[model samples]
Target: MGRGTAAGTVCFAVANQKGGVAKTTSSISLGVALSDLGYRVLLVDLDPQACMTFSLGLDPDQLERSVHDVLVGDAEAAEVVSATEDGPDLLPATIDLASAEALLLTRTGREYALRNALEDLLEQQAAAGTPYDFVILDCPPSLGVLTINGLTAAAEVIVPLQCETLSHRGVGQLLETIADVRKMTNRGLQVRGILPTMFDARTTHSRDVLDDVAMRYELPVLEPPIARSIRFAEAPAAGRSILRTARRTRGAQAYADHAKSLAGEREAAS
Candidate 1:
């Protein structure tokens, strides 16, 4: 596979400035869903908390290498990638990543660190005849250097939001960051859509907030809101996505549908 043939790899940064918005959950679940569709996917844990790494059943404390190592050039991106039982590959994170922002601040072209690393890995994988189809980044809970690297690397952004006032507060700030990123770094970056996570259809307030957000931002709300489910919390303990831990549940089904919708959109765009 040549470099030109590797353009099919789509990178997504699942980002929101606010914590507990299901960024890691959506990243893992969506990667699993895409893998279920036979696409080779890689989930990159950009959060210093290593939530995505721990969520996939890996103990970050015990890892010899992580995304932090890759970012600091101590390791290649491929070296940090581990296979998950759920199907997609993961570039795990560790608490050591907390210092990555400060380290990157002194470096030139720091925002392209993730993009350059991922592109090199993708080229190698393409040469190996097993190219990844997608790369999903689980960004940190802040708009710091790590998240900026994520936004700069990704071609599109997926913001997972809880349907509530406090959760919605950061959307404007996130959009502003996206606007800045588009102007300053990744000119092709776009907000794919807003993903409503931990949504409860039974509550009228949830519905109202969702509608208001869509109207206010004039952004597409990705279909099939993920229903509030305890299974999301339970999956991490089991080292799998909700798709596997509770395959028949509403949340898993919604994510499966979302992945299929994303594939359809990609096809249409192509």
Candidate 2:
């Protein structure tokens, strides 16, 4: 319901209904980049797949508690939050999250579950003088209850669009979902813009797709598109972001620049 935390934590949901669009990658990268800028960040693994959790070097299967516990009312978010080696705190996910939808469907005001949990956590953290500067929600590949919770909780949504024809196909539908979330749950929710990922300037198709989506959806396309790099694939294996694994790579630099711009925007707004 609130646009940000009392301590000014800007929440972002990196969402795209389509899979393999670098949603998790962007989430982890941005979180780490923000942390590198000396801000405290929290990365919430809302996806049942737990890709972000594992990518951050945490094993979802071995975890005693997770975000699933928080969402199901069995545990508070602070109780389940863990520190990642990569500089950000994480509310990890497990396969049990796959059942959260069915369980939440029977609960009243289910869509606000995440928003309420995070608000409570923020209050607790702020009281302790350890407030986060950013919260990044890595949404799943489907517009399910989990994704709805993410949208309802975040003040802004960053849609990661792979530079391909089919990648932009679901942008319209996702936009409609955001609009509905605004009307029903989080009226303060806004689309940060479409983030072009895995862009290949060497190909005209990549350039064309980026141009077409911006014009068609009338959404701001963030500058310096993330280029395709094998380093992105290798980082997960190393349990780090591209920023750490390949610090000097173009893809890593793009995310750093993006994070700086985001931090600057928040500063400007304040």
Candidate 3:
């Protein structure tokens, strides 16, 4: 692990309504890349699957605290945060998160639990002087409380879509949800950009999806899409990111490029 960069808060929700679009993969890898660039990143795992939690080698079952506790008001945000060797911090989720939906139905401010929790956390961090530069929320596949909480908490949303036709259908639905969140909860929110995942130039279908999405959403598209590569799949299994697993692979380089673009520190790579 290396030192981190000091910057202002720039929170983003890595989201998409469709599953298997590499949303979590983008969140985890981008967090690692941002950390490598010296920014202190906080990854909020809102997914019930806990893949992000386990990918970092944290056994959620054994941990005394999780994001569920923080969101449910049973624990403080500080208590649930855990530092990592990858230069970012993580708010791990647990199986109990699967029940958070039904449990939150009775709560008055169910949609704002995560937002309130983060505001409370920032208040404490601000007094300390070394505040976080970004908070990346890895939202669950569904647009439920978990996803809404992330949308409400984040300043921007990054939509990750696979280069496939079916993956294109949910963009409008997610954006509509984002619009609703902005109308009621967070007006400062905006769409960061759209990222195409598992993109393979060899496939004509990939090109069609990209063209269709560009003409439709009209959001800035991240070029040099993450190519389908074995390295990206292998990196997480070892609790490592592409920068470590296949640092030289095109897929790894693509993630780094995406991070640089997000931070406005570097232009998109060719």
Candidate 4:
């Protein structure tokens, strides 16, 4: 309903238990779009696969520090933050993050680990007068400890749904996990909306799935669904978001408009 913290930063976790729903794409696109609008933004890569990290043009293997280090308490989040060419600062991840799950499981209050880390980062940034306006977390495609941490740290969750049959099968399960997170960890966590990605406007099946999701879940479907595009795939190779690489494309324009709408909502809410 409101921003996550009193510090005025709105943290969004783009998550879905099912993969290939454009979670990473949405995270990068949204963050970059917001940054382009002059908002200070941070994008955190919580996926062990480091797709976001690689997509932002960073070599996870070459990095000496990652979100794994921050989670393990070996490094502060500020120390791991790297400025990306995509306009937003990044908290990169590596394969080592996969082990963080077992490590965090053995630790007490593991669900709040990400929240604590981000809060500390936000405080430090605020003190420097460069506070971020938004934080976008690209959660791993699972309901594991990592995703739990991401959910716990975020104020809102954006479910990126592919408008295809069976693609939304996991939305129900994810809602259950969000409910559990609210009951146990972060009560302020809210579902922002379902974002349709890779949408085929020409297909009635796509429209059918969107309608069914809205009717069944009673959740709002964000407007101007991101149309399916090969350009989305190509942008990552250049280590940039579609907004930067394919500025004139419909998919890019959709994300830009989505970011504006979300930002405008936050402003209106405030």
Go through the candidates in order and give the C-alpha RMSD of each one to the true structure. Answer: 2.0, 1.0, 4.2, 1.3
Better of 1 and 4 by lDDT: 4
Q: Write the per-residue lDDT of candidate 4 for residues 84-203, one digit (tens) a residue.
A: 987999999999999999999899999988889999998998789888899999999899999999999998999999999877698999999999999999888889899999999988
Q: Give candidate 2's error at residue 233 in angstroms.
A: 0.7
Q: Model 2 clash pairs?
A: none
Quote each prediction's TM-score.
0.96, 0.98, 0.92, 0.98
Off by over 4 Å in 4: 1-4
Clashing pairs in 3: 4-38, 5-38, 5-39
Q: Kindly give the stretch of ten consecutive residues in candidate 1 with the minimal lDDT sum.
A: 1-10
Give the CA lDDT, 0 to 100, for residue 80 in model 4.
Answer: 94
lDDT for each residue of candidate 3 in 55-86, tens digit (9 for 90 to 100): 88788788887899998899999998998767
Flag regions of model 3 displaced more than 4 Å.
1-7, 265-270
Against the true structure, candidate 1 has what lDDT?
0.88
List model 2 lDDT by residue over 1-270, tens digit each.
234446888999999999999999999999999999999999999998999999999998899999999999999999999999999999999999999999999999999999999999999988999988889999999998999999999989999999987677989999999999999998889898999999998999998999999999999998889999998999987888888889999999999999999899878766
